[model samples]
Target chain A: MRGNRIRGHGLAGYIVLSVFAVPTLFPIYVMLNMAGKDLFQYTLRPLLPTFPYHFENYLYAWQFLARSFFNNLVIIGVSTTIVLLLASMTAYALARHSFPGKRFVFYAILCVLAIPATVIMVPQFMLVVQLGVVNTLFAVMLPYAAHQSLVIIVLYTSFSQLNESMFEAARIDGAGHLRIFTTIVIPLSKPILAAMAIFEVWWLWNDYAWPSLVLSSARLRTVALQLVTFVDGMAIPQPGQEMAANVIAALPIVLLFLFSMKTFISGITSGAVKL
Target chain B: MMDKPQVLAGHRSARRMRDVRIYLLMLPSLVLISLFFYYPAVSGFIYSFTRVTTRGAVWAGLANYQRLLADTRLIASFGNLAQIVVFNVIVVATMPLMAAVLMFRMRNPRAQYAFRLMYVFPMVVPMVVMIIIWRWIYSLDGGLNILLSLVGLESITRAWLGDRQLVLYAIMFVNFPWMGGLNFLIYLSGLQSISEELFDAAIVDGVGPVSRFFLIELPLIRDQIRLLVLLTVIFWLQRFELPLILTDGGPGWASMVPGLRMYHSISRDFNIGYGSAIGTVLFILVFGMTMLQMRLGRRRAAADNR
Candidate 1:
């Protein structure tokens, strides 16, 4: 009787979940299907493909959107690394040690997190232009690093929850602060760090506003910025090519999410629930 | 005795040295934050008061504020944003909550995993790509219309995003899938933390699912709901990419949101002062809403704990 009840619940859950899943997957499926078709066929028949699947759209997107995509990758890679390192070091100090003005500094960081990035975006642009890093990749990295400090604080809170006796044991064995951080703290904080890394990666990868502001050089555009240009630059109204570009743009992140879904979900949940 | 006092003094100095070491470790982040964050934040506020230009900013005092008030387009943008906020808060708050409840009742782990993954897939897709995908789906001969026609609801097959009347709601539909992951995750966690014994207790008391949810689960996860509502408001008020990509704030600015309007005012028109003013207004609105949310959240948390 219990087994039957459980099976019934599972069947019901599957049905309900599928209903929700359609909207999620349908758009991407349409994009893929449309991208594989020729433009003439797309507009003329609109419903059916008149030709075989062409891999040419991906190649075209690569050539056209290559610079921006590379730019986004560079921004994501560098900024995520910088944030992870800086945030980890800072979080370690805040979590494990007592220092003057620590409480004030922590609260100040929280306040900064509350201030929406949109509010500072215009002024930040002005500052970037004045500094003459406008239209440069560095322009993208600087603000991203700044805006991402909150993640550091979040990770720090998680790190603080670790048992103190472990640290004390390492200290008693004469391991120094840097050694403890490198050999002990980092390895144990893997789950949270991985979570922060994935979150930051997704954020920087898809970020549009700052990149749009700073990267005026066509060669320095990110994927998101490139997508905007792709749509705007289309002269013959090719939905297939546009969809192809989106697929190319979306593939890496989609793959990353699939591989790391459990880690990502758990990390986000743990961080959020604590708050 | 002199030696003993000297040893004690040395011990104090060593503790001070450790404190300095901690501060030194923290220094890099502090410097980065000060240079990049605090400096820009202060300058952002300062810039709001001045007329910034290629020649540099001059003290404009209340001129920018007055301009913001008088600009019909700016006012219209705020009005549009208010409506978007209402729609967004309702959809984001309600839909995911329902989906989450359905998710919690499921017994099979595999089915639950699949559902959770599907819900979160949209979040993984970049915002711009998602917008493009939605645009294609909402096209005149796009999948949505085709699906509608097949279901014998051909009258509902109007240009989904292109029609001025239906555009905003269409935008909301796109937002729905994007928000599901976060809300579902929050609700799932809240549900997991609720003891099964409580549900059993309620069932024994002859309470139905609806009443049990209201009298038990709803009151328990009040904090999550509050947090989600606050986050929904902030995100909606600052909404940009969807409007920017899908409508370009068009069909005659029918979907012109404040963030996009602020972008257009400056980027399209080079109206720096006007854009800054608009941004300041949005900042104030978000700040006010967030403050209200925090207060309510605290009150509810306090009451629940009691």
Candidate 2:
């Protein structure tokens, strides 16, 4: 009877796990199938991948949305670069030094992490309008970077894990704080930095609301916003090619996820750092 | 005495220089974050009390807050949002924990690795695409209803997004396969970090797998559970993306939440002050929830230590 129960439990485990697997895998198949077919084939063979593949769907999808992909790339690049440079600087200072107001700055940033973007967005939007950066990429990237003090805090924990003696020895050798930060701190934290880089890049690529609020011009929309605009009928008459735009919008993130899977997972698991 | 005083003075100056440089290094981030994050966050509180116009913000006192309290649409949206939060918290909190356990239980290393690969692949798909694909799935003549007709279950099939009664629940349960994505991975990491010796000791004491998990694993992984719960509440507090993408907060506000309402209010009516007022109230609620959980966790830790 004990042996029989053991066998039953083993079988139950597999069944339960397979059930979880279906939702994730099924959508992927559906998305690929949806992207592969035209409207007629989509109607008839919605679940099946039938060819001559309708590659022209991409052309239709891109007819009005191509500019958005470029704009998204620019925003992602600018935001990620600014976030990395500034976050590393703030993190380095917080990790290695003692100064007046250091505790205050750190605690303020901790509070900032909990402040939802939806809440402060109204005033943030006003500030952008006041700065005369409304309808500008700088508006999007500035908030994107400033709001990344959470990333700084995350990076701070990693920076704290660096070897103390190396930094002090460099300091003893008359190396300035800038040199020690650049030479010792940056090199030692490459793995975490790389992981944060991948995450911020992927994140900025998908950031929709901030851009939607800040960038009003049709010409300045990101790929994610473009898909929304297209589907909602504000952009253009893109006939029956949403799956194509959806596929394109999802592709870069998917490719990046596959490439940097290890670092991405590590970054999050690291975020589970004890308190 | 003179030599010692000179040496100490020199050391103090060097220390001061390092401190100043540290401040300088942090300068750019401080300035940018102040202008962008802190200034606006503080401004949100101020703006909530004003009526913003092309003529700049004019003081409106408690007018915006008074309007917020009486707004029927906002109240109904909160009622709807409360249901989403409870349902989301229950599903996202428990489902992923169970999956993490199942993954943790596997004996075959290769199988464990393969299952992880399968689960992790979906994290890459942009949130926008996921919502869009789900929209198509829920379409009137889309994959779901079509498949239902083929199987002779057409009566249950209906337009998922359009019908007011079904729209909210439809949006909630639409994530097929219902995998809790990153939360699942986080729990797995939490489980993996638990010492193997604790489980071995339990086995030696004749504990069953289920008993071992409950008695040992669950208590050990409380940190992960707390983390996920906190994150879920914070994210859902300002929940807009789902309603925005799936239904546009539509069919007469069945699926509308406060954030989307705020977005619409500011967009359509240009009621910036009222919108800021709504945002301020939400920040207080979410902030309080997070702080409470954090305090509870700390107390538990203290108790454990004692």
Candidate 3:
């Protein structure tokens, strides 16, 4: 009976799902199709794929967006690395040690999760100005690195659940805090750390509002910031080139998805659930 | 007795000293979070009450709040935000739930995985790319209009983002049939947690599809529903990126939200005090909603424990 139900639902389920999939996948298909067309071809056939594929659109977009890619690489790379290193260490401290005021410290870190970025954005801009880092990549990187609360929280739970005897053995072998952290805790927490890193990278990559505020100079534009500018700032926007740039902007994340599909999905879901 | 208590206190203090190295491990995170997060939060609250200028802040008391009360754009933006938030809450509850249910019920594991990938893979594209495409779709000569003309409905085709009445809905309609991303994943995960035996028993009882959903799936996934609802409310309440990017809260304030107003205050006018006021207001709303969710979550967890 159960098997019958499963088979019964299968056809209808697939049909309904396929119908939904069309709209779900339409924007992406449109992006790739239009990306290969020149303005003339786009005007001629906007919805359907055109022949004599114009790979030059990608070339032109690459030329336009090359700097922003480099900028994003530096900013996201430095910030995510900083966040993971610092957050893991902090999580280790909280998890492994029975420190004085541990509860207070844990609560302090946890409370930052409640403070939405948009809430603090106004005065944070002022703080950035006061520190005199406006229009620099540091303006974006510093805050990104600072907002490591989610990472720290997630790592704390994982680290706390780790086998205490492993640390006890390491300590018996006269391993210092640094030694134990590098050898035992770090190795054990690799999966969680990787997930957190992917989550952070995805977030910082998607982030536009903060980067838009801080990095005003055309030189320091992140891919997201640059993509928006490409559409609006152009004298006469080329639809093909614009879509091509959109693809370029989205390329890293798409590659990330291809490589670590399960991890990418779970990472975002876990991060969001904690929020 | 006093001396004994003092000695015990000293011993505890000594233990704290030995753990000082652990605190040192945490110092960097603490200092950075304070500098970037907490400090600004407190200062933003202060700045909301002061008149911030090029030179410095001046004590303006309730002046910024008074202006905020009288501001027409802010009021309209809040109204717009309400409509958007309501629509999103409904969308969050229905579409993702439907897709997740369908995916969960699929028996072929490979087919299920393929469908899951097909649904989620598109979200990997940065949201801005999708938004920009949607902007084009709503443009005069864009996809929607072209489709309308092709279907002989060109008479009803209007500039989707330009019309005042339609702009908010246009912004809301960006990711149509929004059965993807975090919400869908959360719902699917919730469904997968249900035991196979329970499902088999339900099937043995000859429960119909709709009845199975209402009886088994719906009750079990209530926690996930509550979570997504809370998340949806909080998300739509503060996000103005759609408005800021596409119509720019325009066709004259039709799509404005408080978050966008706060953004303009800083970026366009450097009206820091007024912007801070808006931020403070949004912060209170977001924080209050979050606390309410936590309380309800705690109550539910306690009931589950019982």
Candidate 4:
């Protein structure tokens, strides 16, 4: 009977979903369509993909695309690795260990979570200047890793929930803190680690606000920064070339999300606790 | 375990070594936070009081704040941001709830998965791309007014981003079918976490779907709604990307948000001290709100306890 009642709404649900989903998807569809169309024609026939399809738009945009994309990948990749290591290790200690003033340490990290990037980014820029890393990837990665306090809290909750007996048995076997962290806790917490990595990567990849400030040099700019330069700065980039650049910028993360939808989605639902 | 002095001493040393190792392992994150997070934050506040230049920062007292108070652009930007927060909160809070209700009602697992995939797909698309696409769509001859005119609403068509009044709404409404990219999935997860037995019992008692939803699912998912609302407010407050990309704070600053104002203060205006002042204000706003939120969380926990 429960099943039958649920089945009753199936048809109506599809109609309703189509109503919302189609328009929800329309802007993206138009984007993809624009990317593949002629620069001159898309303005006139903005709704449909034009021909002969300017597949060459992508080809033309490719030269200006590589360097920024590479910079984004490098910065995001390095930062994510550092975030995972630091968040996991710190969270593990906060969870399993009984060190002096542990609760204070944990809450201190959590307090930092309340401070938004906007507040710190200005001085962060000043700090970058003071450190002489103003235009380097290190400048981006340093602030990037430091802001993973929320991730630490998320992983802390995950780590703290592990059965206490498991750690006890390891300790009874004369396993040290480092070994147990490596052998038992880390292996056991791969899912959270993966989730943390995915969560960090998604944000770090698309991050614009900070990187735009820090990486002012053309060669050091991430794809996000390059996208801004493409649109806002230059009149040279056409509708076609710009759309191609936008599509190119968006493709990797879109592909990443598609391939790991479950992991990515789960990671997000849990980690949406982030500011 | 303490039968002999030798055994006790060995155990004490081992435990001390473990504690020392634990602290050592925790050092990297501490160092990074101290340098990048706390130091910058403290300095950011201090810098707000000093005029930063290439040569060195000099004391500027309340001059930056005084200037900010007089700046018409800053005042107008705050007004715009307030409007954005209201509309953004409504749209983000409700759209996903509606979608989640539909998703929870859908019987077919395959269809549910498909819809979830479709809704969440945009979240992965870089935000810059989304802003760029909208920039085109809202262009004078771009798709929006073109589509609007073709639908016979020709009288309403105008330059979407060029008109200061219209541009704010243009930024807010561009993702029109804002089934919302990420929060949709978050809401779905929240709805799915509800125990089926509650629904079964409500049905047995002859409650209608609407009653059951309001009386049960709505209250149950308060945490998710609150979580989403909190994150949306905080995230949007600091958000500059859309304004920076979509309108560059507009033909006249219609969409100039505090975040963008902060960016411009440092980058465009070349007043690091003033930017820091802006950042400090933003920080205080968020910090005050989050503290209030934590107080509410504690109150809720106490209620649950009782």
- Report every candidate's CA lDDT: 0.75, 0.79, 0.87, 0.80
Top TM-score prediction, candidate number: 3
Q: Per-residue lDDT tens digits of candidate 1, residues B143-222?
A: 78887888999988988777888787787777445436677788767877887777767766877656756888788877
lDDT of 3 by residue, A90-164 (tens): 999888777568899999998887888877899999999999999998999999999998999899989999997
> How would you order the candidates by TM-score, starting with the best?
3, 4, 2, 1
State the C-alpha RMSD over the true interface residues for candidate 2, after superposing those residues.
5.0
> Pairing residues by index, what is the TM-score of model 1?
0.90
Give the winner by lDDT. Answer: 3
Instruction: Give residue B136's lDDT in candidate 3 (0 to 100).
Output: 86
| Each candidate's interface RMSD | 4.7, 5.0, 4.3, 2.9
The candidates' DockQ values read: 0.46, 0.47, 0.55, 0.58
Of models 1 and 3, which has the larger lDDT?
3
Cα RMSD, model 2:
3.6
Off by over 4 Å in 3: A1-7, B1-17, B300-306
Write out the backbone clash pairs for model 1: A68-A221
The positional error of residue B128 in candidate 1, measured at the CA in angstroms, is 1.1
Each candidate: chain B TM-score: 0.87, 0.91, 0.93, 0.91
Q: Which parts of model 4 have CA positions greater than 4 angstroms off? A: A1-11, A233-236, B1-9, B297-306
TM-score of each: 0.90, 0.92, 0.96, 0.93
Task: Order candidates by DockQ, high to low.
Answer: 4, 3, 2, 1
Clashes of 2: 1
lDDT of 1 at A252: 86
Candidate 2, residue A169: lDDT: 75
Measured over all alpha carbons after superposition, the RMSD of each candidate to the real structure, in angstroms, is 3.7, 3.6, 3.4, 2.6
TM-score of 4: 0.93
